[model samples]
Target: TFHSFSLILSVGDIGYYDDAGQFYIVERMKDSFKCMGRQVLPTDIEAVLLSHADVAEAAVAGVPHDQYNEVAKAFVVLKPASQNKAIRATENDLQDFVAGI
Candidate 1:
């Protein structure tokens, strides 16, 4: 048995192509928002936020802004390891952590 290539249909999927000409699916159209004229995907930021050692759980949303129309606002849950620890994650620390990347 074999399969044949046919028509392609888009169902709110978002992706990009690299220099190698390979396509990569990154997110869904519904999951993305406009920020500073650029598409911002909450999942992308959530992935970055979850990379932090102190982030036990993370969720990001687009919040209204004066200049940018919208911006990412993350609601994060700190890991138990951060409780009473010297290296606890703070708002500024988390912001800086993402910014540094």
Candidate 2:
């Protein structure tokens, strides 16, 4: 005698595969938030932040804003080598970087 079982699960993760059959996790579906009626992906912002040489790690999340309903806020950790550097990054610099991208 044999028994069969069926199972279903929803992980809420977004992913894609490359041409070479390499799998990549883009972001969590639930992690996306809206701002000004536009859905914003935290991973997209994180990618921009991580592009900077000074940024070692970055996390982005939605925060309440008086306008636009919500806005993206970034938490960044600087590279150890950058900490002792005379040239330091400022808020404007990060903002400008994101804006440029």
Candidate 3:
């Protein structure tokens, strides 16, 4: 479909602006997962995971699901404070946090 070489190219990144007017590329169009008959953007879930004070880093990937075809599996690195014995952060607690959002 190309007659001549063109310098313009599309990177397929999806971006958005927040309330502060900050431009951020949340996810790449190719990276979106199909779940519940809809597209689930990893960055959207990552943003919510990062909102938690205990989570220092977060990553989401598509995993096989029986009903939805695919689901988001999150990997998180907790902050130093949360690692302390005084602060108890359970797997269920983190799951509930994401589910609440």
Candidate 4:
């Protein structure tokens, strides 16, 4: 009888090696959610939110949506310096920013 041996390690993450033998950890399974039938990685949205000049911090989560089943909602913390700016950012402003991307 011939048998193959496989070993597994509990690293608490999922990753893959690219064609170039580069290892990349896409996202932690627990931190990912479904949005409109697509897998949405929180870090992806967080990265976009953090790209904004006024955004100091951002946390994204999946929220219930009647039509889409789930949608991304962002909680943004603005920079202290931006608070004193003459022009304040509005919801539409943030929406437009993300839409542009």
Candidate 5:
């Protein structure tokens, strides 16, 4: 709190894209996550996760965090090959890649 100058800011928390060539922010700031003190875009991470060979589909969501403010939680669907072979990427490797970004 800033002494003698306490204030609150309200901001959009959700976003959407339309076929009409427009995108909109639709939700609250407290619902979002900051990666490296910058907004960690959910769509961006979804794209990255889907790019992995073993991943068939992925959904990224923000998890509550006391330090990072928030962290990403990915719910993924595995490819047939990956499911059969049980192939998987190590958590360290994924974290390293994301950390590098």
Candidate 6:
């Protein structure tokens, strides 16, 4: 009917802490990418994608690149009406977006 201190701390250390050490709930952890040796936040990308009328859901990931080391790859789920929407956006588009951040 008892538990060690290590077990208690381990069970409670599941969240994000900022520089100030304030804890916050993490909705998702896989939604992160590293580009040009920097952490590219996905919430920004998701915000932009959501702004577009066609995009329903978007998931982004870092894909290996021969030159850049890693590049952002967006897996978008489009609305039914936009199913036929072409993949007009290119890797350059994502690069530009990340750069602007």
Clashes of 4: 0
What is the total number of backbone clashes in candidate 5? Answer: 5
**Superior candidate under lDDT, 4 versus 6:** 4
Clashing pairs in 1: none
**Candidate order (lDDT):** 1, 2, 3, 4, 5, 6
Query: What are the per-residue Cα lDDT tens digits for candidate 6 across 1-101?
Result: 12122211222222455655554433443555577788776677777776666567775556677776667666676666645765555446645654575
- The TM-score ranking, best first, is 1, 2, 3, 4, 5, 6
Stretch of 10 with least lDDT, candidate 5: 1-10
Candidate 1: worst 10 consecutive residues by lDDT?
1-10
TM-score of 4: 0.63
Clashing pairs in 2: none
Better of 2 and 4 by TM-score: 2
Off by over 4 Å in 4: 1-29, 82-84
lDDT of 5 by residue, 3-79 (tens): 33222322224455555544344444554568558787777887887777667876666766778776787656666
Give the number of the best model, judged by lDDT: 1
Candidate 2: where are CA atoms >4 Å away? 1-29, 81-85
Model 1, position 8, has a per-residue lDDT of: 27
The Cα local distance difference test for each model comes to 0.74, 0.73, 0.72, 0.68, 0.61, 0.56
For every candidate structure, what is the RMSD over all alpha carbons to the true structure, in angstroms?
Answer: 10.8, 10.1, 10.2, 11.8, 11.8, 11.2
Model 2 worst lDDT window (10 residues): 1-10
lDDT of 3 by residue, 1-101 (tens): 22232232133444555656544445545678899999988889999999988888887777778899888888788877633456855778889999999
Q: Return model 5's CA RMSD, one decimal.
A: 11.8
Tell me each candidate's TM-score: 0.66, 0.65, 0.65, 0.63, 0.53, 0.48
Q: 46, model 5: CA deviation in Å?
A: 0.8
